[model samples]
Target: MKIKLIAAAAIAALGFATSAQAHKAWLQPSQTVFSDKGAWLTVDAAVSNDLFYFNHVPLPLERLRITAPDGSAVQAQNASTGKLRSVFDVELAQEGTYKIAMVNEGMFASYKLGGEAKRWRGKAEDFKAGIPAGATEVSASESLGRVETFATVGSPTTGVFKASGKGIELVPVTHPNDLFAGEKATFQLLVDGKPAAGLKIEVVPGATRYRDQQNEIHLTSGADGKFEVNWPQAGMYWLETASEDAKTTLPDAKQRRLSYVAVFEVLSQ
Candidate 1:
């Protein structure tokens, strides 16, 4: 089935305490593919950096959802969250691919005094604590962060790679779950359910050892909203893109930025 369009709604994020460093969410599994009849999959997740270990904190379970191998919704079981990490387990019931997605969006305000930008903060409840009394004006905007990944139990399936129709989605022209090092994979960027042309995309090694921003491959989508990249080595990687909207009428800001991220692996030859 093709992607169904859904309106990107703002999440009411109040009383959210965030770390100083920018936190990005990722999904890591004990094994990407299963060979046993009763294999179980374990996953560790967090809004973190420096590889799997948490640099920020764990993402709330309410923000996550999973689609199973046969395209049925699967609930993440035994979920737990702590200061450093979040872990969960999923039991495999089929022999195809499974997809997990986490989405978060909220309103943010930027403080400026005499045209000098001071700070930016999200969650309506943090406004008083974030903005100082001397601030002359405040601009408000909407923001969004999205993450997606896949795991398989035998051969990979394409059911979950279809766009979710909400943000800057990467629709794989080549099968995302069947990538290999040294092979070029193509993807189409869709912004709000339509082709997104001239968008910048970054493909970076997902490991902390190779995560220098200089090592990332940067590409731009063409008129067809498609871009291609070839992995230099076998490893997990992240593909991300973002866009800004200046049409927000929110009381706190003038513009908004939306970002999308996806994680996948390229197998060794």
Candidate 2:
């Protein structure tokens, strides 16, 4: 399957979060591809009165719907998470065009007062399979602290990353042409020169402050030995990966660690 990951500039610009009335909400990968035999749709909502006072809000399943080209509407199933943000999974069978739409009520008011609702539309195709050779590994980690002030927000105290096993190559998704708003990107984690399994991956977008608190997005690996999320907004962001086992140890103490984390710009198309 040809998995095209699109990282487009956010249609809406990022600015300071001033009051509860200015919080914004939107879907990532505003565009997308359906190539997996079965596909999963992951939605993240960021609510901020101003950019600095951002909160990852949990959206209810009833708030959104996925409608296929065939006119079949699928409801999203709630996924597990430890944070305030809510994740929903929708299974796609035969593919064509799909539209993700939000219900115009309830939480819609919160999003509207803060911002507005947006949609991600695209095609879903069959995903191809094959293993690549000589894969490299990349890893990264960063410490998150509460926001103290607007202008002098402190840097992460400690950060580190490591690659799991052997075969997986960790490539930086940096170039503007590499990702867009409505597509999905795939990277392999190899084990002894083969696709690795049970790896832990973390994606952190730049931090913004709201109500004197700091907010970030965190993703764990799925059953496919891969971690995927939609990038709807543009700004500076980081992708970090490490062996699931290594997570048990402190960042300063770890063996067999190979990680990658780099800063990338998500520009508007």
Candidate 3:
């Protein structure tokens, strides 16, 4: 529910250090199964460019939440962080798909307009209203990162596909939990509840605790805001997309950006 806001001035102060290192957060569970009781799943989390490489670090519990099959909260406990990634555990008491998500709300501004770098936090509306009156030219991208995945126990369910009312959400056209290797999976990109077009989405094989890479496919959403991916192998897979509007709506920031991520496992033959 919180995003790290980057100000136009801050970008200059740091000399735009991390601009090239774009990252996406992901959640991976050790097991997806149903049980009578005492069923637990170990989740490995990280914000990285590669699957599970942990090159970017992991999200804290405050920014992470897991919803149970019955639409209840499933708390993650025993969290520990390292240089590349973090790990946690969650106990499941029901049979259905659980959604684990990491959400951040923030804005990015470019200092290229000259003068001092401006910094703003909190809501996006506040940043829009607070733009300096004297400012003539501004270039920036306000982004929201909505990263999530589904872990299903017993049989798969459709309840986990509900939108969280975030900026850009990936609504699975195919049941995410039912994916299998060598099959096709489709998803719709929802921008403010409607299908979004021309968005860029990437599908890649998830990283292991070590290192590996398979086929990485990049595609653009069609007129219907939908895209499909053919699962190559088994293990874990990552799907991500982002879109931005830079036309400046007025009384609002000059630019806005949005990003979405989803990870799921495919059964191997």
Candidate 4:
């Protein structure tokens, strides 16, 4: 990619939480459904208290991944990190769906050396080596987080919706680009690339700053890892869910945190 995107080494997200007061991270595209084949799509990535409003900090795109309609990797162009958000552009040369994702995996550690508290955040592979000698009360945790948004030039394609089977992910049974208000959309939630039954899903609409209530919708995946959402209105919505287990890839880490966040635009039918 010609754009100077952030490095994965720079990611410092603490962990994933479903708290209402927690700052939510997201990616918002200028337009979700494009009519032209060669259209240009711009995206803004940020983390903030009020959904879609960039107030807290810019989300680093070190682990950013773009997949074209043909299941090919596409490089972002003219990308830049600003004070409040990171901006990027993608040329929709194909006439199908494109997936823009920021995937991250790292560790958070806390220990004591010489009776002093110390903390670290970086790749999980470095968790053991990064620990200083004589560090007592050493404890660490691994985290995997993904933020994504989809854009389609003409018609949406299913090739870009494949799951990595590593952390938690969403495989849309109902095409994302085909979402319509008042209609129910179905999706398969996966953990470790398998059906994630009984996982809680949170769906919150944008423009939360104007409403006194969050209006967040909560749903759970069925036994087959499928979940359904009936959009109430025509607007951009933030959907997120997380799962935790003792399946840490690192020996020193005791727990693994897996989270998924996606932005979807529901059109009025």
Candidate 5:
């Protein structure tokens, strides 16, 4: 129910920094489940207070990654970053699903120096050199975040859903592009390529500024990391899940925080 705001200075490391505080970072595709091939898709990226709105700062595109249905890398075109949002266009030339994401990895740490508490955030590669030698009571947590959305030109494909074995990711039992209203969809949450059992998932419908309440559907992954969501009605839904554990990829850090978010549009059945 609480939405966290981000300062404009956090734009460079949107993913890692936002995980430390909190922000509704998302990639909103203009359309999903397209009926034809070779279609062009427009996507808007932002960290907003309301779902899918551009009232907040733009999500930087430096981390943007586009994957074609064949698992090949695709570049974003006509990309622009504005005050409140970043927009880009992707050409669906391969005739299957496409994954558009801002994948980020960084380090977040807090420690005591000179009897004063200080914090630092930077790229994972900079963790060792960035920490002061005399810093005491040091605590560091690596962060991996993926803000993504999917689009299908003709038929949906699974290539785009493959997990990177780092952060929390959604493995679809029901294809993201195939979701529908009044029906249940299954998905599995994974962290470091393993099952993320009991992790909490929040799914909220878009256009919430006009609504009285969020109407969020809360779910917990099962023992096998699987969970189900029954769509309340046909609309774009923002799905988010986060976890923190001692699964740090960096030995210097004690823990790692992982977050994954995706936008899915459900059609009327």
Candidate 6:
């Protein structure tokens, strides 16, 4: 996975003085789920205060569009949060790739934060729908299963979760049930059908090739074998979980493994 950090230099080069408009970045949604009914596309954007430090007022969204593979345009409404967020809902009846574009509206122009007015543009492509034949769709039940099994057989088993000590377990957490921006949920890894404790975990938001950016989070399992992380913004985030091992341990002992990951949407609340 490609990870791009928005450096201050890059942001400055975009024409904003270092003092104003600290950083401007896009939060791309990682997963798009399609079904016979329609397709659900979730898009997120992240604007740091530093990036907007110089601006007189908050920048508002101007135009947001979604184009289907067949050249059909889907009208996207600014769902919940109006100014600070750029989110859209597009319906898809057929199977194909989709392209989305969002532009910041007049607010930025009026303030003239930068010498030359600029608009934020973001694009998300290949939004897909429908399920493959053999792949079972992820659901709340499946999410529960993985958590249950992981906690049950820790170090002793080949399953993702392994028992590290008498009361501790180590497991890897990844997609299909991974973390997302603006979400608070918990899934556990059981040790012999009991809650495992002190498991270290990391959540990395996925990146998009179109924009070249990514975000990540680090967390730990609680006494109840549950881990909680909140995505403060919208973007594709990758969730990773592993046992905390000492530096003195062998390299193999510290290897990170894939658990389960799922794409999620964070709407304006």
- Best lDDT among the predictions, by candidate number: 4
Q: Tell me the tens digit of each residue's lDDT in model 5 across 1-269.
A: 21121121132246433442435788999989778877889999998878878886888899999999999999999999998999999888888888888887877778999999988888878877888899999988777778888998876789888787877888999999999999999999988888889988889999988988889888989999999999989999998877667877798778777777889999998
- In candidate 5, stretches whose alpha carbon ends up further than 4 angstroms from where it belongs are 1-22
Give the count of colliding residue pairs in each prediction: 4, 50, 6, 0, 0, 31
Better of 2 and 6 by lDDT: 6
Please, what is the TM-score per model?
Answer: 0.77, 0.31, 0.77, 0.91, 0.90, 0.30
After the best TM-score superposition of candidate 2, give how far the Cα of residue 183 lies from its true spot, in angstroms. Answer: 16
lDDT digits (tens) for residues 44-146 of candidate 6? 5433432212222222333444555455666755454444544544555445444443322110111122244323211111111222223332111000001
The sequence of per-residue lDDT tens digits that candidate 1 reaches over residues 131-187 is 777887666676665777777877767777677666577777887777889989898
| Model 5, total clashes | 0
- Enumerate residue pairs that collide in model 3: 2-105, 3-105, 9-117, 9-118, 54-84, 142-257
What are the clashing pairs of model 4? none
lDDT of 3 at 40: 81
Model 6 score (lDDT): 0.35
lDDT by residue (1-269, candidate 4, tens digit) is 10001112113443322234457789999979999988899999988888889887888777889999998899999999988888999999998999999988888777999999987888777777889889999878787878889999877788887777898888988999999999999999889989999888889999999989999998989999999999999999999887778998888788777778899999999
Q: Which of 4 and 6 is the better model by lDDT?
A: 4
Q: Please give, for residues 93-192, the per-residue lDDT of candidate 2 as tens digits.
A: 5444344443221000001112333321111111011111222221221111010000000111111112323323342232222455545555544443
Candidates' C-alpha lDDT: 0.69, 0.34, 0.67, 0.83, 0.81, 0.35
Q: Give me the runs in candidate 1 sitting further than 4 Å from their true place.
A: 1-23, 36-38, 111-136, 210-214, 247-253
Q: Give one digit per residue, the lDDT tens place, for model 3 in 53-154.
A: 767655555567788878888778788876766788888777888888877665555432256665434445565565666665555555566678777778
Q: In model 2, where is the ten-residue run with the lowest total lDDT?
A: 144-153
What local lDDT score does residue 186 receive in model 3, on the 0 to 100 scale? 89
Model 3 regions more than 4 Å off: 1-23, 33-37, 112-141, 208-214, 246-252
Candidate 4, residue 250: the lDDT equals 82
